[model samples]
Target: MTTRNIVHLDADRVYWTTEVTYDRFPARQLWALAAPIHELVIPARLRHAAGASRPGDLQHQLVTTFQRRLGNPVLSRLPGQTLLETTGRSSGLPRQTPIGGRRVGQEFWLVSEFGERSQYVRNIQADPRVRLRLHGRWLRGVAHLLPDDDARARLKSLPRLNSTAVQAFGTDLLTIRIDLD
Candidate 1:
């Protein structure tokens, strides 16, 4: 193996196998190397698979897998994760979707990945009245779809990890602001 690869592997082994805490210098150095490794390993095509110019087959498969098999269940159980409840346009029944957002003052803001085509967005159009579960507490709110908002800037202001996913995978982004009660 190359010297660089050997060192990287050794660092990973030390980090995972040993009892070293993340606060230590060695552990911190290992963590610092993780970003570059992650970037290097994921090919550019795969990283930008969900762009508007790209045919969305790979993106569709990944998103479908996460939403059905992973995202829904995990978000439901997580305490601080946000769950949005909207009335189904067709069935007139309550439809709950796990979403990521930031709360500023009395307003909660999120961007829809599929813009107006998203099912939840359609539900919001039918009825602006909604409910949000934030920090393990359910609160009533009014949903407002902001077509004119700068989605890129808004995404930057939200949580980094979720925003990164949204930016990378989102094709047509539409911002939604909830006026919490």
Candidate 2:
């Protein structure tokens, strides 16, 4: 039997651990490990080998919800380690300008790439109050990062940005935690 470890982490540095046996590991395991790390809750139904498909995956949905929203949510770390701000395009449209809002939970995850140093990062360092729009949905939320040492350490380990954009712009890629208010 395959045993999977389930760890739960709360805002106060509290963590719970449990083990689950399964004939075969499911893809959900990847997100399961990260859910707690990111303060997200995974439904029990998804824990099983055959996880149910999310609602937005179906076509003809009029309005997109947080779960359906797409794109790389923009993030910024506040000064004094107080908070981390996330922002992105709300409508998931390429030309549609981003609007101010909180990033829908589970909509996006941190990528290996370090975004180019631009207004987004500069504004984050200057002020903790930041906004983000989703790539293909109309939703947002303003959040402050919870104080967690482990989370901060994880963010620090991300590979530095060395893309052509960074070289051309002469910008440095910085890593910071995501704090929701």
Winner by TM-score: 1
Q: Write the per-residue lDDT of candidate 2 for residues 1-181, one digit (tens) a residue.
A: 3445575656644344445454556645764664443332333223322354443222112111221243222221222111223333343222221222222354222211122223344444444344333443333333232223233233333323422322223222333333333
Q: What are the per-residue Cα lDDT tens digits for candidate 1 across 7-50?
A: 22353232112222465567677765654444333333434643
What is model 1's C-alpha RMSD? 11.4
lDDT, residue 65, model 2: 21
CA shift of 27, model 2, Å: 54
lDDT of each: 0.77, 0.32
Worst ten in a row by lDDT for model 1? 1-10
Error of 1 at 42 (Å): 24
